[model samples]
Each structure stands twice: as structure tokens, then as C-alpha cells.
Target: MKTKKLVMIPGPTPVVRSIQEQMGRETAAFGDPDFVRDFTSLLDDLKSLWKTTGEVFVVAGTGTLGMEMAVANSLRAGDRALVVSHGYFGDRFSELCSRRGIEVDVLASEWGRIVPLEQIERALASKNYQAITVTHVDTSTGVCAPVAEIGQLLRRFPDTLYIVDGVCATAAEPEYVDDMGIDILLTGSQKAFGVPPGLAILWAGPKALARRASLGTIPDYYIDFDKWLPIMHEPAKYFATPAVNLVWALKEAVRLIKEEGLENRYARHRRTARAMQAALEALGFRVLAEADHRAVTLSNLIYPSGADDAAFRRLLAEEGVMVAGGLAAYAGRMFRLGHMGNIDAHDLVATLAAIERAAVRSGIPVELGAGLAVLQRELVRAAG
Candidate 1:
């Protein structure tokens, strides 16, 4: 059983040893002074990472819970929500809202394309929504939404809370809470945060908090922001016992991110995505995303003509590399390769070689060394 394969999927990216060491520490009580201090610092660092002074919730849940929290806290049943969707996850937001008895209007585009700003404005003009949600980058399609532009458009609608699902984008993508006029930004730790999955982090700005306040007595209990507010302000007081180890791991992850500098890290992610996408192209695969809208955190590459999706992936796994299969309608037709979170040039080179080998073994036509040649050149250009 050969098991040292590279984990190249979009989430739970390779956790560096330092973060693992933090997670491996002895468990501490929620009220322990040391744990409280660490939790408090983690909250502050989260605010720093998102570039906002808003209140953030770090709870034991997945990104879905974060979405539920954002919805349950900010808007009520019968309220209207505008869901701007790029792909699968965007549609998930629509489902979340509709299940809450909220009237949902979805502005969706083709998998690889983003909804034009004019269409979003037209939708806004036609209806009055209490909350509008956008997926920063829909992993299913590898499409990055125009969040900053959407934020700018949202300025005109001050009453609508702007909620961004950063499950696949946070830490790797640009998500400025205050500057982007975002009311709630939710994400999971597994994706770009470079930590094992467990934490669901959500940032609530003043507007979001005020909205929650206005809804005196919400329906939910576990996912409500009201219950977590006091705990966030004073970690010593506990509403629920925190995920102590994952919190520590997240703190260390944030520390590494800070040390590398956000701008540098973001640039590195861009370079990684670029090199992978270029290599895949040289190997005769087409990127699922449009050129301008491709996600920097990951790439969804369409299989070349006559390529066998399962065989290639299986062979790639045998070659000590793993990648994600496409979601929803594109299943069996595309593969999603993650490039974010603690991955480096060597990992990229190994994955590239494995990809080419797997494709060749799967009986897919390819020029030998063609993909690696382009990948090496890109790496050198990035280095120099």
C-alpha cells in the first residue's frame, strides 16, 4: 500500500507540520486561561485576515453551518433573498434560503461564466431583497465571481445584507469585509486555510449585527449569532465548548499566512493556478472556466477529447497524485485540481508529472514531456 500520495484536491490542503503540531497539542478546557487567550487571539487574527473590525464566529461546524448562521441571524422567514450563482455552490445558497421560507431569486450564469453586473442590477431593481448572497469562487466551475464589483453595486441597496460564501475562496481570494461592503463572510477551515476540516468561521459586520438585533428572538439556537456574541467578546464565558485543537491549528495557519504576507500568498496562489492550468492545456485539456473568470485557488480542467475521467483519476492516484472530480452536470467530464494552501513548486511538478503519466496510461493522446516542459518554464519565470 503506497500511501504518501500528494493530496491535490480543493480542500483540506496539505497541512504543514507546524499546523499539525498545534493540532496535536494536549486538549484544554474552554475556560482554561491558555485556551481562552489562544481563542481570543485567533478571533483577532481572523479579523485581521479579512481586514475588518467586525465580530467573527469560530464554531464546530462546516461551511454550511456558517451559511445557515448568516441566513438565520440576518433575515427572517418570508424575507426575500437574491442569490447570485456561478455554479453548484451558488445553487446551494438558493436551496438554503428557500428552505428557510424565504422567497429566493437566483441570477445564474453558464458554468464557466459569471452573471453580468447589469443583470444583477436589473434583478435588484425588480425586487426588494433582504439579503443577497454571492459565492466568491464556486469550486464546481472554477469561476471567480465579481465580488468587488458586486459589492460596489450593493452600495446602492443599503437595506440588503451582502453575504459571501468563501468556503472555497477565503484566505486565498480577496474578501475585504468592510471595503467590499460585505455584511457576512462565511467559510470552512478545510479549503484555503490549510487546516484539517472542523471549523466554520463567519464574520458579521455592524450591519449584520444590527439586523440580528432587529430580529428580536430568532428561531434557531445552535447557529444563532446572538448566542455566540457574548462568548466571542469574552472567551472565558462559554456558550458551547469550542473545537480547541482545530482552533489552535487555525491560529498557527493564520500565523503562517501573516508571516508570508497576504499579498505574497495571494500572488503565489495565482502563480500556482496559472502553472497548473497551463500544464493541463499543454497536455491537451481545456480549462472549464473562462480565461478571465478562472479561480486562482483551483482549476477545473475539462478532459480532452476521448479521455476517460475515472481511469485517468485512478491512474493518477496510482502515480501518487490525487485530484477532485467535477460536480453536478460536469461530472465525468472534468476534474478539479486544488492549488492553494501550503502547496509548493515541487508538489506542482510532481502532480504535473503524475497527471501526464496517468493520462498517457489511460490511453489519452499526449506529447511526452510537453506539459512538464511548460510547467517548468512557468516555475522558472515565477522564481526569476
Candidate 2:
């Protein structure tokens, strides 16, 4: 019997059967009544997911577009923005700000760890930034930033907008956008949304909109909220051709999330990640992220001294399991395993088993069945 393949990357994660089936259906015309209804429903669902009653935009692009949209519409040239970076994505935010001619002040944290809340507080206390961007989960190192505290801290700087990159943490993490005082929360369809990668979903609170209103001109035309706001207000209107099939699939994905219940879904991801970490540690693989700072969506593991990263990953691939390589400075030194959206304990069991087999093949010692046993035990304990 042939073994089925599994994609365990952090992005473009495993899609549920229902969502995949929705994508295969006949595409709807842009102005079709059914399409408009579904599109409008998706926007509403996105607002609910973000826990914000503000404006939501579903752009036909990737998470990067969502990031840019937050910056482009809210901050004009010469505006000072503070970037809180823990990893590569954080650096990307600063780069995006630079491209727009916005002055950026970066308070970078050590990779694989959360940015210290005190550092953010100090930055805000000293500078009157117009906008502040933080990655809720930095994909590069699986580090979960303390967005809640950061959001609370931003209250002191009431004029500063809080932009959170939730690409990897959105539904996988417990995020209450309005409660946290987030001015903008952005995520992509491929990560925790359990859908395909064409949609950029973002919500902007009233403060962010007011800041945009104050701006003289926004250079980026396609991502300008002003152009898309009317279309969002009237679903029948068109700013640009939307991805109809993706929109349909997104609605189904949101329905599945709703059926699962957001709280339960977040707990499942946490359980899966905890089990994965326990099992990997039992296998002698050191985790790169600290215990408290780890993300429920993904885990970054440092390869053992004797193991060859390439060969180990290749072996896992041969066993029908796929994982992501490291990014930026940690490239080739570690590996990333995604446990978010549509992933379950059984999937992690299979993944850990594959890792055991791969480690043994890579000349790394591993007691037979050790990793799987730990994974099972951890999962059961988590469930209890």
C-alpha cells in the first residue's frame, strides 16, 4: 500500500477536505449574487474571527500585502513608526516602512524569544510614533510575541496605531482584537485559516481609519483602503476582480472554524504543539524557542550535532512527510514543524514517528518507539 503524503509547513498548511472541495467548484462571476453574498459573509466572518467590529478587507494577495496595506493607508511620508521585531517578519515590517518613506525605529529582540514588553514600553515612552507594528507570531523562529501586553502598553500612546501581524497566529492563538486595543490585525488564508493562499484578510479599527483619513495621499493604489472601502460597503461594487473561488473556499473554512468553536480550536493547536515539543525533546532534538515564548502554530527545532539537516529532512520527505527549513540566520541549522489548522494529535504521532525513523537513518541514536510514546502521553495529559 502506498503511504499518503503530508504537508507540515507553517504556511499553505494542510487544508480540510471540505475547503479543498469548495475550491474545486465552478468559479462564480464577480458580480454574481451568490458570489456577492458569500464575499460579504466572509468579510463578516473575518471581523468575528479578529474580534473587531471595524472595517475588514479581503485583498487578492498574500500576507505581505496585508502588512503593506496596514502601513500604506495609515502612515504617510515622514511619519514616524516603531517596529517591534523578533525575527525575519519583523524585519520585513521595517523594510516595508522604509519603502514607503516612513521613518522607522526598530526595537529588535533576540530571535527565538519574545520581545521584552518593557522594551516596547520604553520605546513608546520616549518616542511619539504614529504607528507601531508587532508580529504576533514570528514565522522565522516560532516565537510568540507578547502582543497582549504590547497592546495594553499602546494605550498610553493613544495616538499611536497598533498593527499586529497575525499571519501565523490568527485563529491558532487566543487573540481578542478589540479587547487588546489592536488598530489593525492582519492574517493570510494559508496559515491558520485552513484555506488556499490567495487571500489577504485584514481588519482595521476606527483609530486606524481616522489616521488614514488624516493622510494626504497614499501612493499604493491597489492596496489603498479608500478604493476598497466602497466595495466592502457594497459587495456588488468592484474595485478589482476578487478571487471568487478562494472567497467561496474561505467561507467554508470560516464555517468549519465556527463549527469547531474558536476556543476549542486554539486549545487543540496548543495541545498539538505541546505534544510535539515533548516528543521532539525526548528524541534528543533541542527546541530553539523558549518554553513560554513558543508558538502554538509551529515549533522550531535545532538539529542535533551529529545529524545532517539536509539528509534528515530528505529522509522525512521520503517517508511522505514534509516540513520547512529554517529562515534567515538559522537557515540549515534548524527545522520547523507546523502543527496548526487541520493538524491533530494523529498527524503529530505520524510526524514524530517519521522523525524517529529519519534520525535513526541519519546516524543519530533514538530508542525505538520512544518519541511516539512520549507524544501519546503528552497528548493524553493535555487532553485531561
Best by TM-score: 1
Q: Each prediction's Cα lDDT score? A: 0.91, 0.88
| Candidate 1 weakest lDDT stretch, 10 residues | 45-54
Q: Can you tell me which runs of candidate 1 are displaced by over 4 Å? A: 1-3
Positional deviation of residue 52's Cα in model 2 after best superposition, in angstroms:
1.3
Residue pairs that clash (backbone atoms under 3 angstroms), model 2: none
Root-mean-square deviation of every model: 1.0, 1.2
- Residue 23 lDDT, candidate 2, scale 0-100: 91
Positional deviation of 348 in candidate 2, in angstroms? 1.6
Task: For residues 1-384, write the lDDT of model 1, one tens digit per residue.
Answer: 765789999987888999999889999988999989999998998897787878999999999999999999988889999999999899998998889899999999999999999999999888899999999999899999989999999999999999999999998888889999999999999989899999999999999999999999998999988899899989999788889999999999999999999888888888888888888898899998899989998999898878899999999999998899999888999999998998888889998988888998999999879999999999999989
Q: Mark the 10 consecutive residues where model 2 has the least summed lDDT.
A: 211-220
